[model samples]
Structure formats: structure tokens, C-alpha cells
Target: MPPPILVTGGTGTLGRHVVARLHDAGRDVRVLTRHARPGESGIEFISGDLLSGRGVDAAVAGVETIVHCASSFKGDPEAARNLVRAALRAGRPHLVYISIVGVDRIPMASPIGRTMFGYLASKLATERVVAESGLPWTTLRSTQFHDLILMVARKLARLPVVPAPAGFRFHPVDADDVAARLVEITLRTPAGRVPDIGGPRVYGAADLLRGYLGAARRRRPVVPVPVPGKGARAFHAGANLAPDHAVSGRTWEEFLADQVGDAPAGG
Candidate 1:
């Protein structure tokens, strides 16, 4: 039997799906979560926090490869440092990291973007550490998830008119597809800084919202507001998309339809 693989953030949006995929493949799997719920059959769960390396060491024990999905977008640099140290001590050979597209090109937008930049910066810094550590590694940078789009659309639905950030375009990929690609990366030999993953096509923020409203049969007006700043400028310029390296299966429309189902008459 192969050695157990350790997955951090196994209960998160993408992590949970990854865990299920690994289990389905019949791989010996162990997850590190702050809270371990019972009835997660065919897998082992360990309670731990990534910030202080609390249960990280034990979780990595006897594990050959690690799918490191845990992250602190707000305090990325420090979190990356701690996780790198733990992975080093455990002598793990392969480390697969999931990061966002345009981390290097786009400036931080809101507080969340600033924090996410800090986190992506930390992931980049850790990427260097893994490269220098002589351990095999793969870094996958993906576009925004479909779930993020749905969340944004739901928030916009609250307003009589939906207001969208000007010029920002998204190729929203499905989280499940991203997870599948990540798992495939783990199964194969490490490819340093793998190709960028993106959704099937590019669509502006307004287009996404309109599609959502149309699907739900809501007739809310959409207002596009352009902000003046590097972040805004970058998004308006479509900095988050990589046309040359897109590897996603589901389109944004397909994803929205799946979530919204059929629109009712006169909805």
C-alpha cells in the first residue's frame, strides 16, 4: 500500500472536494482540520491549527506527499514560514500549493485583496523555499472560483439595482475542476510552477451579474461603477485572466445554471 497522503485544509471549500476525490481513488488519506466531525468514513482526521504548527508535525508523519491547501490570506507571510518549517522537519518530498492568478501583476484592491496579496506573496515566498529545499514541488495558480461569483451575485440581488465593479473580468472556474487538477498534480511527478488554470471563457462582472439575474428571472438594473486605482485599473484591464493557459472544463453559464436551476415563469 502507498504511504498516507496528508491534506491540509481538508474541510474547506476546495479541500473538502479534494479529500473526497482522494478517498474515492482509494488512496490512504489523512486530513488536518481544527474540528474533526465523526462519520467521515474511510479517512483519518487530526485536529490542528496551521498558524502555530500545533498538530501539523503529527499529521505529516509517515506521509510522503502533501497537498497543502491551508492558508491565511491576511497573514500569509508568517503562515507560510511556519508551514514550510513543519514540512521540512517532516521530510515530506512533494508539496503542492494552490494560489491565485495575477498575484504578481495586480495591485491589491480592497482590504480583502490586500490580505489576499499578503497570502499569495507568502505562497510565492514558500514556493522559493520548497525549490531551495531540494524537495519536488508544483504550484498551481487558478482564476476565481465559481462559488465566489455566486456569492457576489447573491449580494447584488439585495439591491434594487445591481452595481458591479467596472472593467473587472472573470473566467470563473468550478472548484471541483480545480480540485481534480490539483489531485492529478499530486499523483504525477512534480512540475515546478505548473500552467495557469482558468475558466472556459472570459466575461465581465456585469455580464456575470446579468446572467445570474436572467437565470433567476430577476429584473434588477445593473450599474457598472468604475473606480480609480491600480487595483481597479488592473481588473478593468483583465489582469486576472490567462488566455494562453486556461484548463477548465465547466463554463460560467453552466455553473450558474447548475446552481440556480430553472427560472420560474414571471420570476
Candidate 2:
């Protein structure tokens, strides 16, 4: 019998897609999660916590590849540390990590790095741990997800007038597009830091909100809000874009049409 392909955060936005693809391809899957879950056709949910190192070693046992997709707003670096330690003890399966683009260039170099770009710092710190860990590793840096942008737009639209960050732009990619690429990578030998992937087009934050409002069949005035700090400057300058490496993905306009075309009025 073949060993199961382990996926962290297998229930999350991106991890679920990875799990589905792997399962469809006839690969048995093991998911490390905080809650207990019933096993599926070819999927087994293993109880583990990456942040505290509890049950992580058992999850890593007998695995040949690990698609690490679990992440939090905080403690990402610590979680990676725990996973690395366990993988080493279990003979070091190929570690595939999903990270965000521009983490290295986001300029999180201060005592207050965690204030504005805390998530960026967390991802960067985790990247360092993965790179330095002595295990055979592959890291894929990707742009923001379309689902994330939609969530932000929905929140901003709740206000009578949305405050758009001045000069903020993102090249958002579809999560499934990223997941497909990731599964392809996972099926192969480790490649260190493959090319970055992004959406089909770049859209300003306000433009994205406008797209959402249009799809949701609501109207709201958008006002530009000035932002400070080098971190903000980086985002303003398209630090999150990957034009040269854009994936053939679902466009923002298309995603809005699918997800928001049926939203409640003013939702």
C-alpha cells in the first residue's frame, strides 16, 4: 500500500482544493487539523496542532510528501518550526509550503513590523524556517486570492462610503488556479522556490470594490484614503503583482460574476 500524502490545513480555502485534487488522482490523504473529523473515501483526518507540536510527529510518520497549507494570522513561524522538527524525526518527507508573494520585499524590518504587516512578517519568518530546515523543501509564493479580495470588498461595502487605500493595488489569483499548480509541483521532485503566480489582471482596491458592488447590484461612493509607511508604499508600488508570471486564471470580473451575482441586496 502507498503512503498517504499529508496536507496541513486541509479544510482551508486552498488546502481543500489540494486535498480534492490529490484524492481524485487516487492518492490517499492525511489531514492534520485541530478538530476531529470522520475519514472520507481516501482521506484521513489526523488530530494535530502545528503550533504546539502535539501530534505533529505522528502525522508526519510514514509520509513521503507534505503539502503544508495551514497558516494563521500569528504564530506561523512557530508552527513551521514544530512541523520541521517532526519531519526531521520522521525521515524528512518533501516539504511543500505555500507562501505569499512579496514577503521578502515587503520591508518588515522594524520593532513595529508586526503592526502594519504582521502577516507578511509571519510568512517571511516561516519561509526562513523552511529554507533553513535541512529537509528537501519547495516553496511557492503566490499573489492574493480572489476570495480574500471579495471578503474585503464585502466589508468595505457595508459602509455608506468605502474608504479605499490610496494607490493600493493587487494582482489577485484564483485559489483553484494556485491549487492546480501546487498539485503538479507536489507530484514531482522538490523544486526550490518555483516561479511566482498571480491573477490575469491587476486591479486597484477601489476598482475591486466597484466590481463587487456592481455584481452585488448595489451602489456606494468610494473615497480614497491616504496611507503611510514603507510597507504601504511597497503595496502601492505593486509589490504584490506578478505580471511576468501570471497564471491563466479566472479574472476578478468573472469571479465577482459567479460569487456575487446572487448576493442579497446591499450584501
Best candidate (score: TM-score) = 2
Per residue, candidate 1 scores C-alpha lDDT tens digits across 1-267 of 898788888888889889989988888788988886663566889988877778878887878888888765555555555666777787855888888887777776577556535555566666666566566788898898888888989998889989988887888888888999999998988898889888777888888888889888889999998766676677777778977877658777777667896633322
Looking at candidate 1, the ten consecutive residues that score lowest on lDDT are: 112-121
Clashing pairs in 2: none
Which candidate has the highest lDDT of all? 2
- State the displacement of the C-alpha of residue 148, model 2, in Å, after optimal TM-score superposition: 0.7
lDDT of each: 0.79, 0.89
In candidate 1, how many Å is residue 265 off? 15
Q: How well does candidate 2 match the true structure in TM-score terms? A: 0.95
lDDT of 2 at 257: 70
**What TM-score goes with each of the models?**
0.89, 0.95
